[model samples]
Target: MFYLGIDVAKAKLDCYLLTQLEPLKGKAKVVTNTTKGLADLLIWLTKNHIPHDQLHVTLEATGVYHELAATQLHDAGVCVSIANPAQIKHFGQGLAVRTKTAGVDSQVLARYCAMIKPAAWTPPPPEARILKGFLARREAILQDLLREQNRQEKAESTVTPELIHQSINDSITFLNAQLKKLQSQIDDHIDRHPGLKNDLD
Candidate 1:
């Protein structure tokens, strides 16, 4: 069996492949958090003759960055595990990894996967996924709003414009609407899943 480890980031992923008694092989892959990237990875795996069942993929949970890839891989019958970042960090610390680079990090991750042998963990169901999305979107919108407000406040009285204010208002309204929609979806999903609903309550 081959162990695959991923160091996930917002725009890219560092991938490592490890087989017993062999040095880890690393690849730096651009991931747009989209289906295309997932498909490309699947094709690469197929070309390498790595069966989905034989390949164990592990990635640290870096917020929503890992969600899309995990979802696609799970749907494709790949064994995917999400590791806690803190645990991975502590593990890496014990390795005495002095040099840090994307490739090095990837190799470290692969070794960690092999040593830890974490159980497969799928992406959360639709309800939790939506909630995660909403939380991320809400954070982004809040940051943008804060930045814009700060810019407006810093501007000279003569330079501040009504249009900027109007644009900010519009963006806030749109974001709020999207957040509300996501919350509603989460609520509906939780209601349907009695266990989840009880847990939430």
Candidate 2:
């Protein structure tokens, strides 16, 4: 299996393609960190005569920067391994890598993956990701509502001015409405996306 190593960054992805496992060396390329860039990367692979099913892409997780590429490749039927950062680092250390450059790091990643054959990682499906976003917003609104409630309670218990209590009460009411609206939106979204509903069920 051909291994492709990617060193993910916020702005670009440094890649090293390992056509053969013997030397852990091949072509190096840089692509922007975006969907368009991923598309171009696929085109590059096809131009190299590499099929999606035969490609094994590996990269160390760098915050959320790696997620987009992983998801895109996985969806395109490419095997993707999100290597453990610590493990990748140790593997690179074993190689005695001197200066850390995009090219060097990507080369190390390619070598480690070619030898270790790390387990493939799967990102959440699109429907699941949507639900996650909704859930995150819901949690944030809940936290805000709780804070407002706490403030209201304190105001009622202390010598706080009446206007302060009224303001807190208004905030609590607004938050409640927002929570209800958000929940409705979430429900509607799930209904629109059967996969999400099925997952929840």
Candidate 3:
């Protein structure tokens, strides 16, 4: 089995290809972390004559930066491993890897994965990801409401314009209405998933 290790960053991904018998295939390369870039990487692999089914990609989760790549790769029928950073780090130490760079990190991840052969990662369901996004939006709106209310309190009777005060109140009202709608959707989603509802209960 061939392992492809990727070190993900906000703007780019450093990739290294390896095989169990051979430590490295070629020099590591960097590609922009975008859909087009990922496509190009696939093309590069094909140009190099690497079979997709023989490849297993691995990377450390870096917040949401890794999500797009992982999802895209998985959707393309590629196996992906989202390794724990601590575990990867320990593996690096075990290999006596004293230097660190994006290329080096990718190499270490590939070597570690080749040695350990971690299980493939599955992306979350689309509905669950959407719900999570909505929840984050709701939280942001609540925070905005809190901040506006605090500002209103501080500016109370301090010669603030009536129009400005009214605008703030209107914003809060809109946010509250949105929050209610969001809560209803969330509840409906939870109800649809018996396992989630049970866990919540």
Candidate 4:
């Protein structure tokens, strides 16, 4: 099987197409990180004479940056694996990859895929993805609330201005409202998805 290693970033993807592992033969190409770009990547594979079934695409789990590529590639019948950041780091280290450029990262990932053949990734259900997004936003709101609370406490200890206190209180109030709304949404979502609730429970 051929391996395609992609170093995903916010704006673009650095792809390394591995033809062989021994002696390490690969060709690098970059594409925009968008729906059109993913389609273009498919055409690139065709031009390179690589079929989808024979292709094993591996990419790092770079927050939501890698999601589109992973989901699209999986849907396009290409074998896709999402490697954890830690796994990629350690694996690159094992291969003695010193340079930290995007190109080098793609090459290392290509090598890792060819050698290790990690497990394939199944895209999460839509409900799960939605819930994850909600939870992530909730966490951010909670962090904002905590920071505001901390600031208020610190300001109280100091001879801070009344306006600063008001500002802090306002932020805390907004964050609390957001958190409450998000929690309610989460609960409503759980009620809507019995299977998800069962799995979580």
Model 2 spans > 4 angstroms off: 21-24, 139-178, 188-201
What is the C-alpha lDDT profile of model 3 across 1-201, one tens digit per residue? 677899999999999877443534655778999999899888888887777877889999999899988999888878899999999999999888899899999998888777888899998777667767777888998898899888788668588888988988888888889889989988888777656655445
Write the residue-wise lDDT of candidate 1 on 146-174 in tens digits: 77666656653556688876776677677
Candidate 3 similarity to native, TM-score? 0.85
RMSD of each: 4.6, 3.9, 2.4, 3.1
In candidate 2, what residue range of length 10 has the lowest lDDT sum? 16-25
Candidate 4 lDDT over 28-141, as tens digits, reads 999999999999999999999999988999999998999999999999999999999899999999888888999999998999899899999999888998988898999999
Candidate 3 runs further than 4 Å off: 19-23, 157-159, 188-196
Show pairs that collide, candidate 3.
Answer: none
Q: What lDDT tens digits, residue by residue, belong to model 2 across residues 1-201?
A: 888999999999999998776654499989999999999999999999999998889998898899899999999999999988898788888888877899988988888878998898888877788898899899999999999998888888999988898899999999999999999999999888877877777
Best by lDDT: 4
lDDT of 4: 0.93
State in Å the error of residue 176, model 3: 2.0
Q: Ten-residue segment with the worst summed lDDT in candidate 3?
A: 19-28
The clash numbers for all candidates, in the given order, read: 0, 0, 0, 0
The runs of at least 3 residues in candidate 1 whose Cα sits more than 4 Å from the true structure, single-residue gaps closed, are 20-33, 134-196
